[model samples]
Target chain A: MQSIGKRAAMLGVFSGGAILLGYVESLIPVLFFVPGMKLGLANLAVVLALYYFGPGDAAVIQLVRISVVGFLFGNLFSIAFSLAGGFFSLAVMCLAKRYGRFTVYGVSTAGGVSHNIAQICVAAVLVENVKIVYYLPVLLLSGLATGLLIGLAGDETMRRLGAPPKFYDAVSNQ
Target chain B: MKHRERRLNRWDMALVILVLAAALAGFLLELTWTGQGASLQITVDGEVFGTYQLDKDQTIDIGGGNRCRIEDGAAWMEWADCPDQLCVRHTHISRANETVVCLPNRVTLTVLGGEDGEVDTIVS
Candidate 1:
């Protein structure tokens, strides 16, 4: 078993990496025509944490990343939106991973789609107009594409880093 | 061992197909719901500013360094000084309920149709 200090260090590293990735994502030019679409690069850290350290650690990293990024680069509304999306996405991804029937790609894709759906729901409430739902189709497609890309990256990174934790093996074998 | 674990399985393909089908269905549903609107309604900070006939070609300066244009029965954000310019980049909207929103400027332009009364009932 890892020592307490070692586990804490791992958490800190994941959180820090997630925050850095969030900042990098903000630097990319907005994908015009789709107001909220993004590559979601920061999710890589969360995905890694989920697979290696489990859902609890992944949730911690996600929350830290969203709060820090929102405060630094966005307003209250953006923060609320991020919190909603982050929580919903993390929940769905956790469930998908726990089911053991899906690979990383499937889990991440589900996360991406849930994130967008949560944000759109928030937008509808704030704007007091359901017409915003019209953006759903395009947002869904973008989510699928970006999620697949993140999943591919996450899988390759884990492979190169060496054998996954024993838990991952057990999950996969099941 | 890891390579086999990373490979896409049938479940993954099924999930992707399901999401794609959902998107396509949503697109078709939206197409059926939208129709040519009669007027353009402008709102700022949650207050209704004014309504202009879509048939009338005109430019509306929404102050706060944002402008909207209506022509050929369609309305669009003509210009915006907001740093992101997301609203300005949006495509022209001619169908009922379509909108161009400038979050930074707190301005929204929505297309309204004579038949919108029915849509509002459904939404509410």
Candidate 2:
């Protein structure tokens, strides 16, 4: 088993990386003139955490990234949307990883779609109008595109980093 | 430590195709579901501002910062002083329940009372 200190340090590093990626993502312009459309580059860190550290650690990194980045760059409404989307995306990704015989691309794509749906749902509830769903088709396509890119990037990074230590798997298995 | 090759499998291909199909389905469904709207309703900060007939070709200044235009039975955000201007870039709305929203200005224009023949009974 890895020492507690070592695990904590790794978690901290991953959290910091996630936050930085979130901030970088915020800097990208809205693509295709679609409101709330994003590249979701921050999810790269979350995917890495999920694969290497398990869902529990992945959830920690995701929440930390959302809260810190949301407060830094967005308003209350934006934060609410981000939180809803992030949680839903992470949950779907975790489930896909656990049950489905899916690779990184499948898991990330599922995460992306769920994230967009969750955000739109929140928008509909807040605006008191269901018509906002008109954005779904475009949002879904964007999610799929970005998710595939992130998945490819994540997979490459994992390959280069090689496998985690045996004890790392032990921690994730728990 | 060496890991197995990380190439995508059939499941990944299936998931991608599934999402693409879902998107296409949603696009088609929306196209068929929306009917031509008779009027457009304006809401500012969750409160009703006014409702205007879509047949009336006119420009309305909303909250002194945004402008909406109704022409040829379609309504769209013609102008907005907001920084983002997302609403202004939104496509025209002629279908019932279609909307153009300006988040920065807290304004929303929703189409109502369409050819589907449901009268909007909600007052104010």
For every model shown, what is its TM-score relative to the native structure? 0.85, 0.84
Candidates' lDDT values, in order? 0.83, 0.83
**lDDT of candidate 1 over A57-98, digit per residue (tens):** 899899889899988988776787789988899999999999
Residue clash pairs of candidate 2:
none
- Where model 2 places Cα greater than 4 Å from the true spot, the runs are A164-174, B1-6, B35-37, B44-48, B61-67, B71-73, B78-85, B95-97, B103-106, B112-114, B118-124
Candidate 1 global TM-score: 0.85
Model number with the top DockQ:
2
lDDT of 2 by residue, A1-174 (tens): 267776787788889998898888778766566666889999999999999889998999888888888788876667777889999999999999999999888999899888988887877767666677888898999999999999999878876776556547656456
For candidate 1, write residues B1-124 as lDDT tens digits: 4554437888889999999999999989978877879888887766767788888888888865788998999899989987678898898999887877776666788898867553231110
Which docking class does model 2 fall in?
medium
B24-98, model 2: which lDDT tens digit per residue? 999899778777788998888777788888887888888799999989999999999976677888888888778
Model 1, A162: alpha-carbon shift in Å? Answer: 2.8
The weakest ten consecutive residues by lDDT in model 1 chain A span A165-174
TM-score of chain B of each: 0.78, 0.77
How close to the true structure is residue B116 of candidate 1, measured as C-alpha lDDT?
A: 56
**lDDT, model 2:** 0.83
